[model samples]
Structure formats: structure tokens, C-alpha cells
Target: MNILNTIRERRSIHTFKDQEVNTELLEEIFTYGSYAPTHYMTEPWKIKIYQEGGKTAFVDAILASYQRIGMLKMDGSPKSVKMNDSMKKFLLEIPHHAVIYFEKKEDLIRYEEEYASVCAFIQNVQLAGWEHGVGMLWTITPYMHDPQFLKDIGLNNEKVKIAAVMQLGYPDRVPKDKGRSPIQDKLEIITD
Candidate 1:
């Protein structure tokens, strides 16, 4: 498939089937992501992939954080847990979860550059997955920044920041294209 066509058709997949994503396909996606360019030789991106039985830690940590911060109000309503558990249930439905992060650096400019590189890397992964008929949704839940939650996910570093949590799987349904603003509105040409 042409790259432009993929970009035009790819949509954020929120729901997925019960099938698991192919391991070899995921490896290929990551391999392509690793080729994303960085300003310097420093590779600042880190990813922790969770799938199958490995998803427990990530889900538990997120639920715990939500409960900790009173995001899930247990006011004796029997259906409250049902409502609050939707996110958890949806997470379980997906075949894979990828935690993306950027390592911190002392230099401000270098830190920004590293983060930009990681962002580009994420875009590459998404595009590559779409080419394979897989889809990914990138999110940054409040729990990602919680120290206890991070520790539960085996990340105890004060120097690393969670950039996103990407959910990946074959889409149960593909969303229709949502048009964006005209390029002319955001673009500018200047030559002096």
C-alpha cells in the first residue's frame, strides 16, 4: 500500500477483537520505529510492551491509581464499578499495550530533542502497524505520572517520563475519516 494512502485511511482504533496481534509483526513495527531519526546519537526512547498475561501489572496499577485518587467513586451503587471498569475492560480487549517513555537529560535542548525523536518514533510505529491492518491508539492516562503506578510497572526512575501508552490490535471497526483543517490555514511561506 502507498504511504500516503495509509496515512489518509488510518484511524484511531478504540475497540478490538479477541484475537492476539502477531509477535513477529510487532517486532517488525518496532524495528521500523528504531530507524526514526534523532538530532544526536543519543537514543532516548524506551518501550515496555505488555500482552497476554503480562497486562495484569499495567491494568492493576491504573485501577489502583484511579481508586487512590477517588476517580472511581464507590458510593454503594452496584453499577458504579460497572461504569468505572469500562476502561479496564476495554484495555483487556486489546491484544497489546506499549508504554513509551523518554529518558531525561541535564541539557534542556537535548531533552527537547530526545522527546521529539521519541514522538517521531511513535508515529513510525503507528504508520507501520496501519500498513499491516493493525491499529494503535496513543494515550497518557493520569496514572502514568503516579510514582506508585510507575513503580508497579517496573519503572522506578525519577529521570524518566512516561510519554504515552499505545494500545494495539486489529480493529473491530474502522472509524471513518475525520477531516482536519486546511493546510493553508496553518502553513506560511516566507522568503526575504
Candidate 2:
């Protein structure tokens, strides 16, 4: 598929079939992902993949972290209990998870650039996965700052930043495309 078409068609998939993503296919996607530009040609990202039974520890840590931070609670609060249960179910269904980490840099500018590069790398992974009919959901949120979660992912260090938590698999269903706003309105041209 053409890049533009892939970009347009690619959607963040939440529902996935109970199937393991092939190791070779994962390699193929990341190989393409490595093509994303990096600062000073320094590939500052590291990927930690969890699959099969390995994902259990990672999932447990994330759920525990959420509970520790009050984002999830089993304190008999109806709303909290419901949300926690739902989130656990959603997380458990994903058979593969890759946590991308950005190695810290001494220079602030380089650090920022590395972060941007990693973000692009992540998008590259998603697009590349799309070509193989794989689904990816890019997530970074409520659990990102959790120390235990960081430790669980083997990134418990001041020098490393959690770039993204990618949920990977074969899609059971593709969501309808929610079109984007016209770029013309958001563009600002300055010629001085």
C-alpha cells in the first residue's frame, strides 16, 4: 500500500483477535521504524517487548500502579470498581506489548530532539505494522509516571524516559475513520 493511503487508512485499534503477532513480522516493522530520523544519527530509543506469559508481569504492574495512584480502586466505590474492571479486561486482551524508552542525553536540545525522534519512530512502527495488517494502539498515560511500572519495564532510571506503550496484535475490527480538520486553517506562513 502507498504511504499516503496507509496513513489515511490506519486507525488506532482497540479490539484485536486472540492471536500472537509473529516475531518476524514484529522485526520487519521495527526495522522500518529504525528509518525514522534521529538526532546526530544517534538512535536513542530502546524497545522492551513482552509477549505470552511475559506480558502478565507487565500487566500486573500497570494495574497495581493505577490502583496505587487512585486511578483504579477496589474500595467498593461502584464507579472506581467498574472502571478498574473494564480497564483490566481491555489490557488482558492484548497479547503483545512493547515499551519504548528514550535514553537520556546531557544536552537539553539533544534530549528534546531525541524525544521527537522517538515519537516519529513510534508512528513509523504503527504505519509499518499497518502494511502487515497488524493493529497497534499507542498509549502513554496514567501509568507512565508510576515508579513500579517503570521498574517492571526495566526502565527505572533517571536517564531513561518512557516514550510509549504499544499494544500490538491482529485487529478483530477496524474503527471508522474520524476525519481530520483541514490543514489550511492550522497553517501560518511567515515570510519576512
Candidate 3:
């Protein structure tokens, strides 16, 4: 598929079919992601993939974080229990999750540059995966900000920043395209 068409057609996939994506295919897609532009040639991105039985611990840590932050109730009431159960089930069903992060830089400008580079890398991964019949949902949930959650997931929060948690798999369903506004409105011509 052409780049323009891939950009226009690719949608964030929420539901995934119950199937395992091959590791080699995932690596190939990430290799494409590595081609993203970076400042000073610092490819500042790292990914920890979780799938199958591995997802349980990650999901538990997320639930713990949610409860710690008061986003989820831990009173053990039927309603809260049901909600947690449903959330666990939904998360577990996704075939893969990639926790993308990068080491923190002390310099403010350098930090921003690294973050921007990682963002570009993530977009490349998404686009490349879409072309191969895979879909990804780039999520930035509140739990990602929790220090304890980071520790549980084996990342040192003080030393690294989580760029995103990408949920990936063969899509169960693709959402309809919601058209974007004309770029002319946002674009500006500056001629001095």
C-alpha cells in the first residue's frame, strides 16, 4: 500500500482477534520504526512486549496503579469487583502490549528532542504494522504516570519516561474513518 493511503486508512484498533502475531513480523515492523528521524542519531526508544501469560502481571500492576490513584475503587463491592474483572478480561484479550519508553535526559532541550524522536518512532511502528494487517492502539493512560506502576513493570521511573503503551494484534474490527479538517486552516504562511 502507498504511504498516503496507509496514512489515511489506518485506524486505532481497540478490539483484537484471538491470535498471536509472529515475533519475526513484529521485529520487521519495528525495524521500519527504527528508521524514524532522530536528533544526533540517538534512537531513543525501547520497548517491552507482553503477550499471553505475560500480560497477567502487567494488567495486575495497572489495576493496582488505578486503585492507588483512586481511579478504581478497592472497596470490594460487587460493582467495583465487576468493573475490575471486566477491565482485566478486556486487557488480557489483546494479543500483545508494547511498553515503549526512553531514558530521561537532564537537559531540557535534549529531553524534548528525545521525546519527539520517540513519538515519531511510535508512529512509524503503527503505520508499518497497519500495512501488514496488524493494528495498534497507542494508549496514554493515567497508570503510566504512576511511579509504583513503573517499578512493577521493571522500569525506573526516575531514569526513564514511558512514551506509550501500545496494544497490538490482528484487529477484530476496524473503525470507520472520521475525516479531518482542512490543513489550510491550521497552516500559516510566514513571509517576511
Give candidate 1's total backbone clashes: 0
Model 3, residue 143: what's the lDDT? 91
| Reference-based TM-score, model 1 | 0.93
Off-target runs (Cα >4 Å) in candidate 2 are 76-86
Flag regions of model 3 displaced more than 4 Å. none
TM-score of 3: 0.98
Error of 1 at 2 (Å): 1.2
Candidate closer to the true structure by lDDT (higher is better), 1 or 2: 2
Q: List the candidate numbers ranked by TM-score, top first.
A: 3, 1, 2
RMSD of each: 1.5, 1.9, 0.7
**Tens digit of per-residue lDDT, candidate 1, span 1-192:** 998988788899988888888889899998788888988767678898899998877787888888777787666587877866786886777889999998878888888899889988998899999999889998878888788888888786587888889999999988888989999999999998
> Which prediction has more favorable TM-score, 1 or 3?
3
Best candidate, lDDT: 3
| lDDT for each residue of candidate 3 in 1-192, tens digit (9 for 90 to 100) | 999999999999999999989999999999999999999999999999999899999999999999999988999899999999998999999999999999999999999999999999999999999999999999999998999999999989999999999999999999999999999999999999
